[model samples]
Target chain A: MNYTDVFGEPTRGKYVIAGINVGMILRKDWTTHQQARDYLCDFDGEPQIVEGIDDEFIREKHKEYPHLSLADCEYMWTGAHFCEELLKFDGFMLHASAVVYKERAYLFSAPSGTGKSTHTKQWLDAFGEDAYILNDDKPVIRLLNGKAVVFGTPWSGKTDQNRNAGVLLGGICFLERADENWIKPVGAKDAAFGILNQTIRPGDKKRLVKLLELLDNVIKTTGVFRMGCTISTDAAIMSYDAMKGETRA
Target chain B: MKVKSDFVLKEVAGQWIVAPSGDASISFNAMITLNDSGAFLWKTLEGGASEEELVSALLGEYEVSEETARAGVRNFVEKIREANLLDD
Candidate 1:
C-alpha cells in the first residue's frame, strides 16, 4: 500500500533538532502534537524527510498494544520514525529532564514518577535566572566534534517546557528518593547502566550498536552522579554543589 | 554451549560490557559487565570452546594454575548462564 495514497497530501513540518534538519511528513488529517509543534522551526536547507509508519506496521502495533488510542499510535509512529532518521546523524533521544545551568546542560534521569521533573523544578527555583529547562523530557543528545551536546526537542513531556537551543552536556544525575539529600560520583559501568535504562533502545541491530557506542562516549566525557534526596531545594543544592565541586557535603 | 548470538561484547573505558541486541535487547532489560578473565573467556567461548579448552586458554593468558583457571571459567559460565546470556 502506498503511504501517500492512504495518508493523502502530507503536511510537512521542518524542525532543526540537535543541529540536524528534519522534515516530518504526516497525513494532513493528523495534526502534529502540540509538544513537538512548539519547537518547530523553518529549515532553509535540505531536510531529511521522516515518513510516517505504514498502515500495516501501525496495525501490528495496535494489535500489540491494544489499549493505545489512535493518537498514541500516531505519536509512537512519528517518534520512532524520526528517531531512526536522527540516528543516522549521530543523534539519539534520551528520556530525561534537561536543564541549562551556567551555559551547560545537566540531565536528570529516573523512572517515570520518580521525581526527575520535580528535581529539575527545584533547580530552576533555586538557581532562578541561572537555570532554565532545555527540555522537560525526551531531549536529543548528539555527538558534535567529540562532545556530547543536549538539544531541546518538541517531544518534551507534560509541561511542554523546551527551547530549540543546544548546550554542551556537563553532567548527568540519576535520582533516587531517599530520606536525606546526598550525591556521589558513579563509575563508568554504573553510569552506562543508568544511561541505558533511560535511553530509548532501538530494536534495529545497527542502531542499537550506535546507541551503545554513543552512550559509552557520553559516560566517558560527562560527569555522572547518583543522587538520593527528598523533594526540597536542599536536594537540588546538594546535587548542584557536588556536581560543581563546590562542596563535598 | 556458547555466548548467545544476540549479545554483543563491548569494551568501554577499559572495561568489558555485554549488551543485548535485536529482539533480545527489548526484553532482556539488563546489561552485564565482565572482568578481564571473564572477557577473555567470553571471547574464547564465542567459538564454542570446551571447558578444558577454556581452562587452557585462561592459563595461557594469566599466571593462574590449571585448577584456578578451571574454577574461574566455571564461575564465569555459571554467572552468564544465570543471566540467560549463554546458549547451553
Candidate 2:
C-alpha cells in the first residue's frame, strides 16, 4: 500500500533519475503537460526533499519566477535539492542540452539564451532521427562503474523536453555564438571553469569535495571542448564531426 | 603565505584549478587556474611557506634556474593575490 492508496492521489511519488530512485511528496497537483507526468509512480519511503529549502526560500523564488504557480516553485525547489543530494550518488547536473547521436550522448552547455537548444534543433533538422534530444536542459552526468554516463531527468528547465534515458557521455562542449562555426578541444582547466559556471555550486565542504572529485574523474574520462558556432545546420555537422568523429554523409 | 582557508586545489586531467570550497564560495565566485609550476607552489603554500621557500621548492623540483623559478612563482602568486585566493 502506498500514499496513493491512503490519500487517493499521487501525493507520494518517486522518479527514476540517473538510475536512482528518488521518492518525494507531491505538494500539489501539477497541471497537465508536465514532463514529470511521464515518470511519476507510487512509492513507499521517507524520500522527501533532502534538507529541503524553507518556505521563505520558495517565497523568494516566487519573486524570481512570479509568473509561475506555487506548484512550479515547489518543483524548482525540489529539483535544486535533488541536484545537491545527487552528490552522494556520484552524479551532478550539468546545465546543458544533451543530445544522443549514434548511441552516444553529447552535452552542449552555455549560458541561458546562448542557443544550446537551437543548436540541438539544427542537429535534429540535419541528422533527422539519427540524433535526438535526451534533455534540452539539465542533464545528469553520473560516474557509473567507471564510466561517465549522462542521464535525462524529469525536471528539465523551461521546455519539458526530456526522456528517461541514460547513455555514455560522448563529450561536453561549451558553446559560444560566433560568426563562423568552429570547435576546438580546450584544456581541462579552462573546461573546468566553464563547467563550474553552468552547474549548481555546492556551498558545503562535503558536497563541494564530492563534486570536484566527480569532476576530476569526468574530466579525465571525457572530451571537453569550446565550440564557437553559428545557427546554421553546417554548425551542427561541424560540431558533431569534431566531437563524435562523424561527418555528415 | 598559505593557501587560503576553505579553498581547494584540484587537478583535472593534469591541469590544476583552485576555487573556494565550503562557505568560501559564497563571496568569491571565480576559479583560478594554475600551470604546473603554479600548482607546485600552491602545494607548497598548503604548508604555509614564504616566497623564498616557494622559490627553493620550485628549484628543487624543476630543471629551471632560480631566476626562472622566481619569475614563475611571482607570476602565479600575483595572479592568486589579484583573485584574492592567497592567505598572507
Candidate 3:
C-alpha cells in the first residue's frame, strides 16, 4: 500500500525544534497534539518529512495496548517517529525538566513523580525573572558544531511548560529526594548510567546507537551532578551554586 | 554457549557498552559496560567459544598463566550468565 492509502492525503505543518525545520505530514483534518501546536512555524524553506503512522503499525500498537484511543495511538506514533527521525540529525529526546538560567539550559532528570518539576519550580521562585522552565518534559537535545544544545519540544508533560527556543546546555543533574539540600559532582561513568536511566531507549538498533553516541558526547561536554534536596528555594540556590563551581558554605 | 544475537556491543567515548537491539530492547532495561579484557572475552564468546577456548584466548592476549586465565574465564562467564546475556 502507498503512503496515501494508509495516512490519506497529507496535511503538512512546519515546525522548528532544535534548529531543525520539520515538516510534519498527517492525515487530513487530524491535528497534532495540543502541546505541539504552539511550535507551528511558517511552511517555508527546506524541511524534513516526519513519516506518518501506517494503519498496520497503528493496529499492531493498539493490539498491544488495547486501551488507547485512535488519537492516543497517533500521538504515541508521532512522538516515537519524531524521536527516531531526529536521531538522524544528531538529536534525541531527554526525559527531563529543562530550565533557562543565565542564558543557558539546565536539565533536571529523575523517575516519574521524583519532583523534577517541583525542583524547577523552586528555581523559578528563587531566581524570579532570571529563571524559567524551557520544557517541563521531553526536551530535544542536539549536538551542533561540537556543542550540546537544548530545545523545547511540544511533548512537555502535564505542566505544559515549553518554549520554541534553544539554548546551550549548561549542566545536567539527577535529582533525589532528601531532607536537606545538597549537590555533588559525579563521574562520567556514573553520569552515563544516570542519563541512560532517564532516556527513552529506542527499539531500533541504528537509532539506539545514534542515541548512545549523542549521549556520550553530552557527557563529555556537560557537567553532571547528583542533587539530593528538599522542595525548598534553598535546594535551587544550592544546586545552582554547585553547578557553577562554587564551594559549599 | 554464545552471546545472544540481539545484544550489540558499542564503543562510545572510549568505553564499551552492551545494549539490546530491535524488539529485545523494548524489554531489556539494563546496559552492561566492560573493560578492555572483558570486551575481548565478550567478542570471543560471540564466536561460540567454550570455557577452554576463552582461557586460551585470555592467555594469548595477556601475559598470564594458564591457571589464572582459567579462573578469570570462569568468573567472567558466570557474571555474563547472571546477566542473562549468554545462550547456554
Candidate with top DockQ is 2
lDDT of 3 at A176: 94
Residue pairs with backbone atoms closer than 3 Å in model 1 (clashes): none
Per-residue lDDT, model 2, residue A148, is 87
Put down candidate 2 lDDT per residue, A10-82, tens digits, no spaces: 4445666677776655544553125566666555665443323345655678888899765577677778888
The C-alpha stretches of model 1 lying farther than 4 A from their native spots are A1-9, A27-33, A38-46, A54-67, A245-249, B26-30
lDDT of each: 0.78, 0.79, 0.79
The TM-score of the first chain in every model comes to 0.86, 0.86, 0.85
Evaluation by lDDT, superior candidate among 1 and 2? 2
- Model 2 bad stretches (over 4 Å): A1-10, A31-33, A41-57, A63-68, A245-249, B22-29, B56-72
TM-score of chain B of each: 0.91, 0.89, 0.90
Any runs in candidate 3 off by more than 4 Å, and if so which?
Answer: A1-11, A26-33, A43-46, A54-70, A245-249, B26-29
lDDT of 1 at A106: 85
Better of 2 and 3 by DockQ: 2
Docking class of predicted structure 1: medium
> What does the i-RMS of model 3 come to?
2.1
Candidates sorted on DockQ, descending = 2, 1, 3
Worst 10 residues of 1 chain A by lDDT: A1-10
